[model samples]
Each structure stands twice: as structure tokens, then as C-alpha cells.
Target: MNHQEVGKYWNENAQTWTTLARAGYDVYRDHLNTPAFFEILPDIQGLKGLDIGCGEGHNTRLLAQKGAFITAIDISEVFIQQAKETETQHPLHIHYQITSAAELPFAENTFDFATAFMSLMDIPETGKVLSEACRVLKKSGFLQFSIAHPCFDTPHRKNLRNAQGKTYAIEVGDYFTNQNGDISEWGFSNLPESMHNLPKFRIPRFTRTLSEWLNIIIQAGFVIEQLHEPRPSNEVVKQYPSLQDSQVIAYFLHIRCRKS
Candidate 1:
């Protein structure tokens, strides 16, 4: 979608932005649910941090509370407004900005850590964003981010079935764009032929394979420090029978790559 349309969508939903952030999305939490906030934050204590695509700044505030100086950023002015507004009495310092993920506005080696949560796939020019993240971090800084799994969460996902009926979702579409990863529409969970009538608002995602993603970090002079597949809590498992081990099936992929 065009930036205007994207801005309109967030503006329309701005009122509920914080509420949703705290409501605990199954998919997002599955990849990120943690014992302590600081655990996911790693060792960024006393270091500058950036939260890219920081809608409503939940994580930004969380990081601030944990004592990391933060710069929270978003592309949508509406979202940035909501984030700043939600932080009415926030004692800690948090700089908020309206900016694109692909083209971050920061000097080289400026941050000690950065994060993008469940927003990478939605971003166009993700490679550029990753490169920018690499550019802005201090030596040995951490760049953590998340996205939906392409194999399991893409529009063309694999389906599971049984004698009774279909048990899981099915998807079928091209993984990579014919062009330079500049997609215009992207949606999921429909019959294969539905692309004609229901062309999703294609959002360009550089179709990086698992190996390719790892290589991006290595090539950008970072090292993979951790890989986590955060499962749901026992409570969520009991509350939602569909979620085995609190795993929100099609939610996100959490990665932590450290600058060398």
C-alpha cells in the first residue's frame, strides 16, 4: 500500500493502538513472551537503543523502564502521535520520530541496540532497513527484529488435513517477487485462485531464506547470538485449545544479530 493509505489505516485505528499493544497478541507473544522484559532486551544496559516501527511504543517504554536510553521510531505520523500520547507521564527520556524503517535517520555507530517487532515483513526495502540498522549500531551492538515465517506464514502456506477434514491452513503463491522484492499486495488464507479477485495490498519483502537471513547478518558484519521460539504460557494453552504449547502458529520469527 502507498504511504498515504498506510497512514490512513493507522490514523483510523490510532485510538485503540495502545489497548491492542497490551492485549497480548497470540502470534506476537508466541515469538516474544518472556520470563522478564530484560531477558528479551539482552545486555543493552546503559546503552542507546532504538525501536523501529515502534507503534504506540510499548516496547520502547518497557526498555526505558529497564534503563536503556531509547529512540522510538515509526513511519506513520498517526502512530507516532499515539505512541507519544500514550506515554503521558513517562519519566524516562524517549525520543520519538516519524521515519521509514528502510531509511533510518541516524548517524553511524549511534546505537547499542535496536529492535523491530513483527513489522519487518510489512516493510518494503527490508534489506535497506537491515543495512541501515547495521550502519547505525556501535561496535558489537545488537539488532533484533521479528517477522512472520515465510514457509508457515506466507500467503502460499502449507496446509494440513486428515480423514475428518482440513486441519490447517493452505496457501499457494510465489515466494519472491519477479522484480527487486518490491511487492504491492500481500495477504493470506484463501484459495489459490483468489489472488485474481482479492489481490492483497502487496508489500515488498526481500524473500530472504533462513540461510539468506543468517548470511545477511554475517555479510553485514554481525553474528547470530540467539534464536528463540517463544511458546505460549500454560494459561494461554488452557485458554486457547487450538494453540499447542501456546504457540501462535503463524505469527513471527524473532532474531538477534550482533554487530561485529
Candidate 2:
């Protein structure tokens, strides 16, 4: 898969994401690791917040409910459309804008908190995006970005093994990401018997190792304050013993850092 072709895939799968997330949130909470209120919500309050790649405006609407004036931006107009529809149904006043995470349209020091929930890896130009995130965050402001853990969330590493050897396996060729970015395979799951439940396809995902993820923020002049590796809850523990002490430590990291 062409690494560059993935973000567009998100545009295509925009509506399905909401459906998938809604389904996961309700039925399969065990497979999900979404932290309550965007990981760093507790650290900052009553300040301007930016939600980059605000798909379906799920987290954006959450931040608004918590009293942060938010600017929600995304690259896909289709996603924006779906997000606005969701907003109308939910009725939250999050300012939605169609924009790319790589090149934010806002001025410097424009926000107090910048968060991209599970979306940074989907954007193509993360360096520019992070720089823009830094540019807009106020001094002492926070940036909390989360992504699928690079080590384990990877498709290659994501699988199931039984006594028969391999019961279920999907493509896992794309893993390491360099300065240029990594193109990874992705797909969607349709509700049974519904062809339009979602389109299944491949796309690219970008991320750095935990060290690289941390160092970039430091070089960008932010001080790491708290690092969160959310362990699976008891339900997960009781359900999947195979995930015990695996090569992957955390499925996601909630980094709270300040631009100091």
C-alpha cells in the first residue's frame, strides 16, 4: 500500500468510523482503550483547545461539555459533514473546520491545549503537524496526542494463535516509520449482511517509537510532565490472558506536556 494513500482512505471511511466507535463504545468496550476525556483534560481548564483530526467530533464534543472553547479541525470534508451531523444530533457547540493537521491555519500561541485523539498517525505530515501544534499552544499549555501503540497495534503483530497454529491472520507488513512516514494497511468491518456497514480497505498509518515520540516533543521545546500507559482493565485481564506481558506494553500513551 502506498503510505501516502491512507489519509484519503479516512475520508472514504469517515462515516463508518462513527459507527465503529459507537459500536465499540457500547458493545466491545473491552477491545477499546479510549481514556475518559482526552487523556489530558484534567490538567487544563477554561482555555482554548484544538482538536486536530477531530473525526466525527466525538472527543471535540466531549471537551466542549467540559468547558473548553474548542476548535475542531480535520482534512476530510466528508468527515466534517458526518461530524456536523453528529453534532446536530448530540447538539454541542464545537467549532468545526475543514483543515489538514499537517498545516494548521491558526496563528501561533492560539490555544491552551492541543489534542489529536487516535488521528495523528493517519495524517501524512506529522512533523509539520506537531510543529503547528507547538506553534499554536500557549506557553505552559499542553499537548496530549494519542495513537495506536507502534509496537503492538501494528497489523503484522496483531493476530491470534491457537493450537492449530494460526487461526486468524491479517497483513502486518508495515511497521517502522521514518522521517518520510510509513504506509500501513487498514480496513473496515461491516455489520453482518450490510454491504454499506463499511467499506473494507487498506491505508497508511504513521507513528514513532515511544522514545522518538518523546524526543520530538522535547526538541520542540516542551517539557514532559506526565506519561500515561493505560493498562487494560480487569475485564480485559479476565478475558485475554494471552495479552499478558506481551511485547506491547500499552495500546496507547497519553502524554501531557507543556510548552515551556
Candidate 3:
């Protein structure tokens, strides 16, 4: 799919996605992605930052709380509207815009840092996003992003469970295939009562191998600083019993890269 196609798909699902973000229904993000991101995130006080694919401004708000001035952008107009609505309720020095990450409508060297939380995989032109990120960042500025782990979260991944309903092995296929399409399942069936009747939403993901991901960053003029595969902590697993399954396989990968 092309960028416009990808944007069209997200725009179609914008309402459901905004509802999920507002209701805090992202189990994987709350339990896994956020913690892993913070582990490597540097102090951003007084820094100007860019947040790409900032759906509903959830993470942008968090960044504001950490004392960073934020310019958040997304491809879906509805998503930008929803994010602005949330900003009205809880003011967080953020500027929300509707724009594509591939062609960032920003001046070069304008940001100290950039972040994309679980968004890069959904972007069709991964290389363009990386290049735009590199261009917009100031000299030596850093970019941090998280994605569905390329090594383990393949298109044909399945869980092998025992007769007692316990997961034993994680089976994966076509790990090297670079492709895009609808994902199996991604909605919160356990949302609050207000959202119980909400429509089920299927995510469209673009898959890439680990080497491809690295090469994209490197080719975009970034030096890889760190790579992280995050899983649930012991306490988190206890709180959310379903997270116990995460130990069997990594769900997300976090990468920190600096402009070279």
C-alpha cells in the first residue's frame, strides 16, 4: 500500500482508535511499550520535541508532563481533531497537526528529539519517515521509536499451547517477508461499559525484518544507540494475568538512534 492508502485506512479507523486511546484500552502499550520507552528516554526538560503519529495526543501529554515543548503530528484529520479535543480538557503545551510523517511539513534542524510510539510499523514508507525524522532533528539530535518486534512478531505468528491451555512454544513463519495488510486482532474487548458496544477494529501493519529496520535508520543518517525488546515486569504480570503470555515472546522493540 502507498502512503495515501495507509492514511485512508487509518482515517477509516480513526474514531475507533481515538475511542480506544481516550478510554486507555491499549493493554500492550500500557503494559509493555511505555515502560520500555522510559527506560531509555533521556531528560527532555526545556527541549523542543516532535512526536510523529501522535494519535489522540496521549503520549504527547506524557511528554509535556516531562517538561518538553511538543509538536505532534498525524496523517488522519480525525485523529488530530480528537487529540485537540483532549488537549482542551487537559491543556498540555502541545501543537497538534494533521500531516504525513513521510513528508514532514517542518523546517530542517528544528527539533532536539523525536519519538514514534508503536507507529513506525503502520507507516508504509519507513525509509521516508526515518529520513524526515533525521532531517528535522538538530545536529546530533536523537530519535526514539518502538515497533512490533521484527524478529518475533511476524505475519504468521502463533502460540502453541498445551492441553491445559498453557502456552508452550511461539511458532512463527515468513519472518523475512516485507509486506503489509490487515492484522489479525487489535481491539480491547475488555473496555469499560461505555465502550463495550464499540466497533471492533483491525489494525493494518507493515512488516519488516530486523536488518531492514537497521539499514533504514543507518541509510537515513542515524547511528543506532540502543535496541530494546521489552516484556512485562513480574509485578505487572501479577496485576494483569494475561501479560504472563508475553514472557514467551517479545511483543515490542525500542530503538534509540542519533542523527549522524
Query: What local distance difference test score does each model get?
Result: 0.64, 0.66, 0.86
lDDT of 1 by residue, 1-260 (tens): 44434545555554444444355532334333433223565766688999988877766777787788999888877778877776666656898999887778899999989988766655545566788898999998898877655545443555455566434544535655222344444333222463346433434443455665677667777788876655556676566444542243534457888988
On the 0 to 100 scale, the lDDT of residue 219 in model 3 is: 98
**What tens digits encode model 2's per-residue C-alpha lDDT throughout 7-104?**
57777767666667666422222243454324445644577899988877866877787788888998777778888887788776678998777778
Q: How many angstroms is residue 121 displaced in model 3 relative to the true structure, after the best TM-score fit?
A: 0.9
Count clashing residue pairs in model 3: 0
| Candidate 3: worst-modelled 10 consecutive residues by lDDT | 181-190
Residue 84 local lDDT, model 2: 84
Candidate 2: which pairs clash? 3-183, 156-172, 184-204
For each candidate, give its TM-score against the true structure: 0.73, 0.78, 0.93
Full-model lDDT, candidate 2: 0.66
- Shift in Å, residue 193, candidate 3: 10
Report, for all candidates in order, the number of backbone clashes: 11, 3, 0
Q: Give the Å error, residue 160, model 2.
A: 4.8
- The top-ranked prediction according to lDDT is 3
Better of 1 and 2 by TM-score: 2
Better of 1 and 3 by lDDT: 3
